[model samples]
Target: MLEKIKRRIEKHQAQPIGEQRTFAVFLPLVKVDEEWHVLYEVRSNHISQPGETSFPGGAVEEGESFEEAAVRETMEELNVSKESIEVYGEIDFIFNQSHHIRCFVGELKHINPDQLQPNEEVASVFTIPLRYLKENEPEYHTVTLKTEYNHDFPFELISNGKKYKFGKRKHKVPFYRLPNQFLWGFTADFTHRFIEIISEDTNFLEGKNEK
Candidate 1:
């Protein structure tokens, strides 16, 4: 088994990176009242993207495996022990121009609102029924990407550089509506993939109550 793993690793090619960061996030599926729901964390106002909703994760630390970083971030944000989390598998990789994200799906051993101990990094925690996501689709919007160069960039260095016009890139972002909350960007994208994965197992999802 070790030899096979080593062979696979040796043959794998790392993705190219040009100052792009890597992050890992775990989607925690908690069973509550015979229904499966996904837990989401709201970033504290003091942190980046304050008040924005996201999964329990952050940038991968140096020399840390993606799975390790995912689990560590979950534990830190949720204040739960490692034993409470059972990582199943990873879904598709998410990437933008500036960063890459790994989304891991996992089950929470216990689900109790009172037991949660969110730290300063997290403003609040909430759960949405998985059935709702499976039944609904996110609204998509196209946003244009603009590029800006530094003031010191020398236009004289390259021929016709001053006259060069950069083309605009369009990105489609999806947003999901819940009572009063909105799930968009990376979180919504990850949820969409999760719904796709679970939809394949009719028996598993049918066991839970939808609503």
Candidate 2:
């Protein structure tokens, strides 16, 4: 298995660049009554990003590849066997300043949501139909993050006792509203792009599945 994975990596010619805080997520899709749906997890209140909806995943650990991390995290959180997951391929990489996320898509085989056990990091599991995402557009909201500095004596040496301009950073946040549920932030960003890619490749807007 390791040899096969090594060949696949070599085929893609992928390499890690520098030292980055990396994360990986699996976009698990399942068939529900002839329609494809995307699964999501609501983070536990005790964990980071509490109550936020995201795909099953976690940080990439030492000696583990991005794909390995994705599978491991999904298994740990959802308590599903690795054999049940069929990883298709990576969709895209999301870069947010210093860190980045490796996004992958896959199908979960014979999954019973009611029977699945969630760990402490997961509050509940839910699904969003692919048709909904392909049809509806996310609400775009922009905000600027201003830099804050402490009052210290070092400002005089750098700016010659004059006030220096510190620029603010702007970001466009995506929000997808589905019934009573709302998906925003990095989760929404990845999902939005995934929908676009599949839509274009498969003519999803015309109600066709990917070949």
TM-score of each: 0.86, 0.85
Displacement of residue 146 (Cα, Å) in model 1 is: 1.7
Tens-place lDDT digits, model 1, residues 56-125: 9999999999999999999998989999999999999987668889999998887685568888999888
lDDT of 2 at 197: 90
| lDDT by candidate, in order shown | 0.87, 0.87
Worst window of 10 by summed lDDT in candidate 2: 153-162
Q: Deviation in angstroms for 150 in model 2?
A: 2.2
Which residue pairs collide, candidate 2? none
Off by over 4 Å in 1: 1-15, 204-211
